[model samples]
Target: MKPVRYTGLTIAWWLVGTPVSAIDVQHSSLVELEAAYAYKTGSWQKQEIVWRPEWVTRFDSGARLTVIGEGRFDAKDKLDPGRPDQPFRAQNTETVFPSDHIDLELREFYLDHYAGDAFVRLGKQQIVWGQADGLRVLDVINPLSYREFILPDVEHRRIPLWSALTEIPLETWTAQLVWIPDATVTESTLPGATYSLIPDPFGEGRLQVNRPDSLADSDFGLKLSTFQRGWDLSLNYLYHTIDDPLIRIDASGQQVLADYNRSHLVGGTASKPFGDLTLRSEVGLESKNRFQDSLTGEIINTEVGSYVIGLDYSGFSDWFISAQFFQTYRFTGTHDNGSSKEQVTVLIRHDAMNNALILEALGIYDLNNKDSLIQLEAEYSVSTNVVLRAGADLFFGDQSGTFGQFQEASRLSTGFTFSF
Candidate 1:
C-alpha cells in the first residue's frame, strides 16, 4: 500500500491557534487496553492500546467548538496494517501511521452554532439514522469500517465524514439537512489482514478500487421527523454513492475491478412504545443497485428494498431483551440462487450488583446461508473511572457461508478502560 499524504496539518495548526481565554474549555481523556486470542489458530490475534482525548470549548456567544483525537499502539499489528488513502473531504482529517504498530488520527473536529431557529454543525462529524441495533436499513449516510467485521459497536465502526448538517424545528416536526463533500467510501481490510474479505486465491494486485474524486460526486440527504400519538416517525432521503463497491472481472479474467455507484435512497422509520414493549421498524428503497452475477460474471442493475423490524422488551427489572428481523429483496437482479436474503438477530442483557456488573449476549443468524455468529460479553465497573470487559466471539456453519468463513477467526478478548 502507498503512503497516504497528510494534508490536515495546516488545519490542525489553525484550530490550535484559536484563542483560549474567550471560551470555556472542558477536557477529558481515556486509555483502553485490549487483547484477543484466536482459539482455532491458537495464536494471538490482537494486542493493542488506544488513547482518546476530547475537548469542548463553549463561548459566551452560544457557539461551541469540539475536537477529538485518537492514538493507537498495536503490538500485534493484525487489524490496521497502515494508513489507508484519504477521502476528498477527509484530507484535513487524515490518519498518520508512524510505524507498523503506531497510529495517530484526528478523529472528529467540528463547530456548532445556532442561527435563529436553525441549529448548524460544520466540520468533520458523524450522522446516524435508523433505529435498528445490529442491522442497517435506512442508515446509509456514513460509510463503515470492516476491520473487525461487524463485531464492534456501530459507533465504533462508522467512519466520520466532512459535512455540514442543519436542523430546524417547525411546529410539531423537525427537519434536518446534510451536505457531505467527503468522497470517502468504505474502508476494507487489506489482503493479509485478519478479517480480509478477499480470497487469497487471487493475488492482492488483482483487486483494484476506483474511487470518485470529483466535487460533483458529493453526497446529500434530508430527513423529517415528528412525534405524534405516542409514536416517533421519520421520512428520509439521500442521493449519494453507495459505499460498497460493485465487483466485476476484467476482460482477461485475471483482475477484479471494484467501483462505487451513485444511488437514490428513499426510506422511513417508525417506533412506538406499548407499556413494557417497544416496536421499531425501518424500510428503504434504493434505486440502481448493482450486483454481479455469479454464473455469467455480468453486472446487473436493479432496485433493492431493505427493511428491519425490531421488538424490545424491558418489563423485567435490570433485564433487557430485543429481537430483530431484517430482509433485503432485489426487484430485478437476482443471484444464481435467489433475489432475496434474510437475517435474524437477538440480544439479551442483564445488569447485576446494582448495575455494577453487566452481561450481554447477541446472536445473528443468516437464514439464507444457515450461518450464525454468537457474541458473549461481560463488563464490570471497578470504579467510577475504570471498567473491565471480556468477551467471546463464536461463528458456526459451512465454510462457504458468510459467518462460517470466519470460523477460524473466532476469538476470546478482554479489555479495560480508564477514564480521566
Candidate 2:
C-alpha cells in the first residue's frame, strides 16, 4: 500500500478504534466552530476559506477524549475552463501533503487517563516544549506545517504525533516519557504553494522518502522537570527522527529524494519570574545532524548547537512585551561552512475596551542575514462566545534569506470563531 493510504488507515484506527479499560462515566462535552478567509496581495498566490470543528468530552474517572478536524476550500481552486491560467484543482486526500487546495484533516484525536500520581495519554496529540516565540530550540517532537507560516498559534500549526505518553510525579521532579510507534514525515512545500525557499524552486518533482515507520525506526524521548527557588527547570533527551527532510537530487536535477536522519538531542530549559517580568532560556545540542545542501541538494551529517533566551514583561498599561534572542551554530555541517546565524524577535500585545479588543504586533530580524518579517493583528470579541480577527503578514530583506524568500507571499487575513 502507498504511504498516504497507510497514514489514512493509521489515523482512522486512532480516531475510532483505540481502546482503554474504564469505569463509571459522568459526561461533559464541548463543541467549537471556526471559520476563516485570507487573500494574498498583488497576485492570485492564495485565497481560501477554512472550516474547523472541535469537540472534547470528559468522564468522571478523569479520562478525556478529544476530536478536532478541518476542511478548506479555495477560490482559485475552482475550475475556469475559459481562462488559460485558471485551472481546476483537485482536493487533497492525503493527510500529510506539502500543500493543499482543498483538504480535510483530523488534526487531533486523543485519550487521556490519570490515576494517582501517574498519567497516560494515547493517540495523536501535540506536545509543546520551550518558551521562545517564532523560534524552535528544544521543541522537536512534532513537525510543523508552514503553509500558513507563523500566523497561526504554534499549537494550531504543530502536526500531531501519533504516540503514547506516560508521566509520573516523583518527590523532587516530574518525569515524562514518549514513544512513537509509527512516525509520519511532513514536507516543506508543495508544487504551487505561496512560499518558496529554494533558489529557482521546482514546479514538478518526485520525492522518494525514507521514513521511520518500521520497527527499527521508532522514536523515544524522556524529560525530567522540577521547580526550585522560584525557578522552573527541565532536562530532556530524545532519540528521534528529524522533522525536516534531507534532500538529494538526482543527476538530472528534476527528481529529489528526501530522507530522515536518526538523531540525539540533549537539552535544558529554565524560567523564573522577577516581579512583573519573566525570564526564560533554553539550549540544546543535536548530534548526527543532517540537512540538505542548498546548491548541490546533497544531504550531509554534522553536529549543531542551538539556544534561545527571552524576556517578557507586563508592567506597563495592560501591555505585554516580549523579546528574544536565538542563535544556532554548526559544529561540523557541510552547509553554512561552520558559521553561526542569529536572530532577534519582539512581540507586543495590548487589550482595551474592557478586554473586548486586542492588538498584537510581532517583528523578527535576522541579525546575520538581515532579513525580517513583521506581523500585525487585532481581535475583537463580537459576542460572549464569538471573536473576530484580522491580520497582515509582511516580509522584507535579501531574497536569499529566510523571510525574504516569501517577499511576494505577504497577505491580509481575517477569521471568526464561535464556541458552544
Candidate 1 lands at a TM-score of 0.93
Off by over 4 Å in 1: 1-21, 82-90, 251-253
Candidate 2 — which residues are off by over 4 angstroms? 1-41, 44-47, 77-101, 196-203, 292-299, 333-338
Candidate models: Cα lDDT each: 0.84, 0.69
lDDT for each residue of candidate 2 in 1-420, tens digit (9 for 90 to 100):
154335544544453344633344333323333333334344554455656667666654466766677666555642111111111111121352224355556666677767567887776678877766769988987777665666568877777766778899989999999987656654344444555222223545444455555347777899999999999999999888777776566657666566677889999999999998999999999887776667665666788899999999999987999999999987755643445889999999999999999999999999877999999989999998778878788888887778887776677766666655
In angstroms, give how far residue 197 of model 2 lies from its true place: 4.1
Q: For every model in order, what is the number of clashing pairs? A: 0, 0
Question: Candidate 1, residues 156-226: lDDT per residue as tens digits?
Answer: 77877777899999899999999988787777776778887754446766777787763678898999999
**Candidate 1, 318: how far from true, in Å?**
0.8
Question: Can you give the lDDT of residue 339 in candidate 1?
Answer: 87
Cand. 1 Cα-lDDT? 0.84
